[model samples]
Target: MKLVLKDYIESLKEEGELDSLLTDLLWSVGIKIFTRPNKGTRQYGVDIAAYGKNFQNSIEDQNKEVFLITVKKGNFDRNNWDSGKNSIRQSLNDIIDVYIPNRLGKQYNNCKINIVVASNGELSEGVIDNWVSYTKEQGTKNDKLNFVFWGIRDLVQLTEDNLLSELLFPEDHRLLLRKTLSFLDLPDYDLRHFYELNEKLFQKCLPLKNNRKLIKNLRLLRLISNILLKGCVEMNNIKPAIIASERVLILYWDWFKKRNSFNEKEPIKELISYHFFKIQINRIYFAKVQTSYYSEDGLSFGIGNLLEYSLITYEQIGISATIGMSELYEAMVHFPSDPNYSETCYKNAMQVSQSLGELIFNNPASCYPKYDEHCIEINLAMILFYQTERFDIAIQWLEKLISYLRDNYLLKEFIPLFITDYEKLIQIEVGGYKEEISSSILITCLADWCIMLKEDNLYKNLIELIEQSLPNIDLQHWHPEENTEENLFNSNAMRETGSTRSSIKLPKNPIEYEMEMVEERNIFFDETKFLHNNKGFQHIEYLANRHFRTYVFPNSWRQLLNTRFCFNKP
Candidate 1:
């Protein structure tokens, strides 16, 4: 598949194909471009002019010499062979005679000029030999002039080395996917091939720029994961799915290590955030696969291997947030089978939870508070304790969560209003509530836990706190300006949604309205501000359903309903 794609790209005759590819190839190898092929001109026979610094220092420090590149695309078949050679000679002549003289008198007199002639196909043996001899002779005549050649094979090798081949030849990727599927039936299976394939797949999906770039890369990542997961599922075997997911974790860990090698001046939060989401997808895949299909033995082996690898990743990469997630995964995996070990796992998780909160969420230097990590950690603690029937520990985590929410002013503003609107919509369908329920989800969860423990005093105090806070939560700040972009989106969502609820409108089928809301509400302090409101509702909904499912199903609560579907079903 790789060879076929390389050949196809080599055969391309479209204008700018060779130039753009050469640009990418040079850029990947740390050549800093001064100018490249301009829109409508041949760029003085120099396809790309760049500083070809020594390879090691090229990326790390400044370059002192210039390299002028000339790229051509053609075979040496009789008709055009002379033209191709002549084109190269002219490009070299331009660099040595005109281009260097023009630049040297101004800014680069002492610097050397290196001529690179890159072509899509090889010259005949005699032609290359003669060309090299003449090029070296010319170099001797001009003390600072040196030259080199990059044939199709060299370019392909460069592309592969830097993991940029997929972007250069996207069609090759599509073809490779087909080829991968075909190899599934082979007697000798190579998991390393699958691993390498996923490494490229993930590299293509990484932001490679900033946090905003991740907004789109995330969707691409999901699309890729879905395709891979779907393919594994179609095999009617869990092993392939597990193998793919294992490879994902390994690659993701390597990405984390690589990010560390980057200069500390770079903003690392976005890269860490990217890793957060990547781990999130892996966690979800494992949860789904475990519940849906895998045998107990398979599940144990895969998750155990994953958890062990995660520990090593934590030690090597030293990202506490990732380790926090690994512990949470460990807890979840231990829950159904090893009840005793589950508690131990959750305890380990809670410690990292605290450390992560202190190091990231509480650090003022952090642009976005690691609220997603906070939520995951807090929820894991809540679920772990609640499952173990430790009401006191569950309440502690719940209180801690409410305090976390209170620290973030935006969440404090949005959660109550969102919950109030949600509850009012609920009452309009059913009857009004017997009591005035407070609009905070954590408060509600605490109330449930308090009642379960028969702590009537604590439950009553919590209710009082919620009732007082709900009225104080100013909804005015929550509403965007009437004519602003935010309000325009809200208006559009309201008009387009066929929702029965009179409070807040559900998004249009596209749900861009929700994205707009997320954008408006996304404080840098918490990148998950968009998700927190939705996830808060989800947690409450899950707890409500769980409450009903348990021995504590009360007559008063019997009519309270669950609207969301569960993904944890067997």
Candidate 2:
């Protein structure tokens, strides 16, 4: 395991990969970093800056010291030792002649500075004498100025001690991670194992005795996830990696929200790093999905079976919808600081929405979902449609869907149900058994959109149709039971009552109905209502959909209700 991790560390790039890992290691072992890696700016050769004990490794306790670290990826050689502007030698020179004299602030200047040249690979034997002479000469100039070098072995040990310790990822979990990496070609089995690992880690972190340990584990999770994704990239299949990263993302969000650690630097920085990895995977997979958008199945990936066609097409469209929402979320969150940040995001979001619309229009399979579990993707697409205010297409689709399900009692073609058990869902599909449709996340969302859009007639017809055709279907709205948020987030159905829902409420006042649902669950869809740095309501539905492994649902409502894709002001 250590050797595998060491190899991945050596494979990392300097800008966003290696530097970020090193920063996490610094924080993990008690180093206080003030300036992190920021590209597209002049940093005087200092890739990272921090203050702490005289030595970086926690194992070697020493006197206090501050640090200016210049990081490089892979092996270091003679050219790196004395090459031109990009060389470590020149970087060290800049750190001393430029950063120390001008850039180092007064507050951190009092302590003797330790200028460390760090890399994830070994230093060439040819550069040994130069390193020795340089450190000796630097020490002679000023007692406070010390020079140091950290190679691959040093970084591996730092990672092993602080992040990859057995105390965090147990033997079974480690095996599961290895299996996940090996199964990149098979996205379903791959995501299953990955999610299992996440669930176990979440359970372990929840009862932690201290935040320090928790942060270390979270940081480790992100690094391991990135390495798995790197493997996916090498193999030319990152679909599983994208879904797995998204799974861990919401898992971390749930943990952060429950632990109230969003304000802490360590976890938030960890999230940002994980988010960066997610963007990388999405960019790669999005290109592949986009290229096939005008194809026969829109996302067939060459799967020839009809059932397989419908499954993959709807799933792909759902993923595209998620990508769109993510783009918009990024824009809204950063809008406060950078007023111009949203233009590109808005464009990207609409482009993705257009892809979804076109995928549905061109691919007949998209309208025919495989099982009730298909609602997860279908609902996500519906959210994107209403969010972009592409109501005509969405309304037409919803009417067709409601009419199809309302009349068909004999066939199990994507019938809505409350249960999320995958095995039972599959059995229903193959065994010729029909679903009771007692609980429905799909109907709930369709009804909410009808009311929100003031399609009063459609809303009334949906309500009456369910009552008459599928009389057993409750169409109940779900609400989080009192103090059951933890059980909800953890997917612990062992609780006495994790949730409750209402019978369909046909409100005469639509505005009052919207506010009542939003405030009832305290689910605010308006991003502007929350602080820029904090999480908003989208996460609630994300967590629910993920944990339930069925529908993109709100915990309140017959299981889906108030959530609108377009950031409804209510």
Scored by TM-score, the top model is: 2
Tens-digit lDDT string for candidate 2 (34-90): 899998899999999998875444756676678899998777888677878899888
Clashes of 2: 8
RMSD (Å) per prediction: 22.6, 5.8
Expressed as tens digits, the lDDT of each residue in 118-178 for candidate 1 is: 7778776657665777687997898877777777777667656543344433655555555
Clashes of each: 1, 8
Best by lDDT: 2
True-vs-predicted CA distance for residue 521, candidate 1, Å: 24
What clash pairs does model 1 have? Answer: 369-525
Where is model 1 more than 4 Å wrong at Cα? 56-64, 76-86, 103-105, 164-570
lDDT of 1 at 544: 19
